[model samples]
Target: MSGHPVLTMKDVGVCYFRKRGFLKRQKIWAVRNVSLDVRHGETLGVIGRNGVGKSTMLKVMAGIMNPDAGVITNYGGYSVSLLALQVGFLPYLTGRENVFLSGMLLGMTRTQIAEKMSEIISFSELDDAIDYPVATYSLGLKARLGFSISFHADPDVLLIDEVLGVGDAQFRVKSAAAMRSKIRSNKTVVLVSHNLETIEEMCERVVWIENGTTRAIGTTADVLRAYMSQVKGRAVPDPAD
Candidate 1:
């Protein structure tokens, strides 16, 4: 699938310091044994419950956070990401400035960023608000702009968080379309979204994380069906027999 895998993870685990006792510092593992391969040109959907370390997985992929165990290999261009909602934006800066900042972080020259500025603005659909301070924009708008900037970077691997819920309905549609365009370009996309329908539609494969561990990894339809079945019976009240 486009030569070799663009991203590979094996026995990857993340741990954080919990407390420093008189004897030692206790650690907590947020995710464990997350070995996965992201072949180029494929979308890998990671779905999990809230606070289940989905964001931490993406961070590991992006090299923002290092793992306590296991190895991660990447044989592609740099991993540019919009890992969290509005993560890369500076509130005091205008949307336009953030685009350049993003490009710089992605290792682009100033001229290169300028070349794609118009495209990002159009894709984000923030024409009127582009020059305004980002803090003035809504959460959805922030997500849209952040995504547009990273999308235009044309990275080999793109890690997107749940920011797809940003923007108005029409803008959301546009963002989804842009996402499809990225997939068609054969870029490796690692998407973390709570919208199960979007996951089913966009992902070629799904990895279901449960309790900070990979409980299932397979076809989207199969995983979703099993996950829903497990979730459905849990919330139902017992009938008065």
Candidate 2:
């Protein structure tokens, strides 16, 4: 299994239902006939417009959803899905307690979380707020805490949905550095973002998805250049001209 891909998909497909009637069902695909590979120590970036199933693809890899048709093989262990920040979070719990709970769900024990609690709080910069109930936190604060907790889990594969929590100018610079650091590990990271520059900087390879299908896959520079060219031509007509 040493040579096996960290994650592999073959002829994958997923469909959602559109209500025609209570008894009759209609299907709308979120991903169709998509095949790809993610190798250990590499970051694979998936980009597409809204509602194009970017998050759905990551969920399938994270084993959150069973594809309608396809084969996904993982040698062993778990993959972390960050599609929804703090997905299983309990509002009643304090941020610190929630972090511990999240770590445990990721397969760690109390002792394990005890070993990394300080690092988690420190990295999140939550400090005193860590004792506050998560339900009382703002969206940004929640996102930050969730990201911090996940980082403490020591994931083998980290699937991130959006870079919303990566913050502003200075934070983005720092976040890019963090993304680079993650890619260097013997782990797989699959990122989905609308941030073209972030994708270009962090990913060596890319998969272009459009309308539930893989439109293209290739080196970052080439795929991105194509994406930009397509978008540039569609720029609104000049009113002055």
Candidate 3:
């Protein structure tokens, strides 16, 4: 991968306000003092415990949410997309209609979506269900549609948040293969996953978040070693083992 940074976050912070009675509000910092750079054509992994602001940071990176403090710089004005299982599909809309809706939301032109419509539906294996209302579809069906839409969107920067385990086993294999192909093609990706094996296999580098802050950032092997050591409270295991 090139050393050129495509995206950079400097001391970024995000906070949320929650109602605490009639006139009081509580402030909760989701991300605090996070600094990192994503190089061009690199798959960066983000690993952290639950509720640690990893998802919030990704939203910031995707420009879905602005940071409360610090700055995020995007070089070359690249388009970024986030792929999560719970896509914002209008429940009452048909799967086909939602495909157009979600595809455009992912930065695909309407014409482009039309060109790829058949392929997306075919890949999703929704078949006749493609015409059914998304509200009537099962969770797996929704995931399939979401994955298919995002996969075909082909954004410059792909931000994935635990969407790999979607659908059935066969679909999981297919999705993983597609993601690997994208990564092999030098597409830039930022993956947030709890599956350490997936991170170790796909990511060249990783950023570890703890308590809404960056705890470690380095080569996959090194950072994972430290993270595992701390989590296990024991000496790190040999990779060969």
lDDT of each: 0.78, 0.75, 0.91
Model 2 residue 80 lDDT score: 57
lDDT string for model 3 (149-186, tens) is 99888999999998887899999999989888887789
Q: Could you estimate the TM-score for every candidate?
A: 0.83, 0.84, 0.93
Q: Give the higher-TM-score candidate: 2 or 3.
A: 3
Best by lDDT: 3
Itemize residue pairs with steric clashes in candidate 2. Answer: none
In order of listing, the candidates' clash counts read: 1, 0, 0
Candidate 2 wrong stretches, greater than 4 Å? 1-4, 76-84, 164-176, 233-241
Error of model 3, residue 112, in angstroms: 0.9
Per-residue CA lDDT of model 1 for 1-241, tens digit only, reads 4446778888899998876867788879998988778877788888878998899988888888899999999774655564344546788998888878767776568998899999988887889799999989987788787777777777668888886655788877877787777776777788898999889888888887877777777777777776777677643221211
lDDT of 2 at 159: 84
Worst 10 residues of 3 by lDDT: 232-241
**Index of the highest-TM-score prediction:** 3
Looking at candidate 1, the ten consecutive residues that score lowest on lDDT are: 232-241
Which is superior by TM-score, 1 or 2?
2
After superposition, which runs of candidate 1 have C-alpha atoms over 4 Å from their true positions?
Answer: 1-3, 20-25, 76-80, 83-85, 233-241
